[model samples]
Target: MKDPNKAKTERMMVKRTLKNLELNRMAACYVETKEDALKLVRQIIPDGVKTASGGSQTLVQCGIIDFLKEHTKYFDRYDKTLSPEGRKQNEREAYFADFYLTSANALTEHGEIYQVDGASNRISALAYGPDKVIIVAGINKIVPNLRAAVERVKRHAAPANAIRLASGRFCENTGVCISPCFDENDLMCHADCGDDTICCNTLIMKKQRIKDRITVIIVGEELGY
Candidate 1:
């Protein structure tokens, strides 16, 4: 289904996000729930389209990843049958997939999506590489502006994600962003968290030259870190 026109709260946010996405040369919609999100993804993606996805808890929870793995030529990096070299090859192939799926760390009301990465493959594919980028995010990820967006990522997203991945960063043990960089102008973590750190890179997605190259689906429920 196209963007729904019911529910005052849902309707308003959908309109705002869509308008800003249009201004930024992207497409977007708001869904009422995780179930709606699953259905919307199916409608957007045609049958047999080669698909790939970055690591995203939102996609997993919505059953989007499972559906793609079963139906499309998905870049299956998680397949244990593949050798180490095969896993590397799959990652390479993901760059050329017809659709690349992922989730954002934070979304600013100003229409920018913010994300931090450890390996940066997700960030790279998000900015460019894939023919089409489909991002699924929850309304909980939304922030007032870029500064708040960055803070949101650090103060909440990072620490929780660190524990999940066992990245062993300061936040993982403490459950909050006590990174020293907060004192400085940058909101990024200047403290070293060893080789397993997840805060190595950051990306703030704003206006894009190619209209509709990216599409965002905002679900009502909270998902991902």
Candidate 2:
């Protein structure tokens, strides 16, 4: 069972985040569980549409990946059967997809989405491609501000993802970013993970000119990195 006080505080935080997201021209909602998140996704995206996704454990946990596979023409970049070139083709083609689904590395209470990427396909798509971008993140992803969001990724998200991907990066062994410490004025890319670092690209999504183009669903449960 959840602690009542914690749950209440989380609810207030979610409410604040949603309000700010709307002000930024992004649609936002809160779900109590991963199942609810998946259900909400289904309602937003219809069947037979072309869909794609950034590699995300949150989507897998919510069964959104499998859902897309069954209901939509999903571009499966993770299909091992596909050659490297084929996978690249799919990544490029995802720009035209009707919907793109992914999870943010961190979300600021200020209503900003922060994502760090290695291949950068995901960040690129979030920035420009697809008719709609759906981000499903857990409450644990929420932070006080952009600085806290960056610290969360460096201390938690990046290291965990590095281990999961077996990227053989420095953070994979160290269990933290190469340069984890940063101040409010520091650049988001203030890291020294070397040439093979997955933190090659960083994106901080703030106000959007395209109203409602991006929808964020924040789950109450702890999920993903």
Q: Give the clash count for each candidate.
A: 0, 0
Error (Å) of candidate 1 at residue 139 is 0.8
Residue 180 alpha-carbon offset, candidate 2, angstroms: 1.2
Listed per candidate, the RMSD to the true structure in angstroms reads 3.8, 1.4
Quality of model 1 by C-alpha lDDT: 0.83
lDDT of 1 by residue, 1-225 (tens): 445553566557656766787788889888878899999999989879999888888999999989998888899876889998898788788899999999999887778889999878789888877979999998888776777777787778888888887856788888877663344455675655566678789898899988899999999888888
How much lDDT does each candidate structure score? Answer: 0.83, 0.91
lDDT of 2 by residue, 55-157 (tens): 9999999999999999999999879999999999999999999999999998888899999998999999999999799999999999989888888988999
TM-scores, all candidates, are 0.89, 0.96
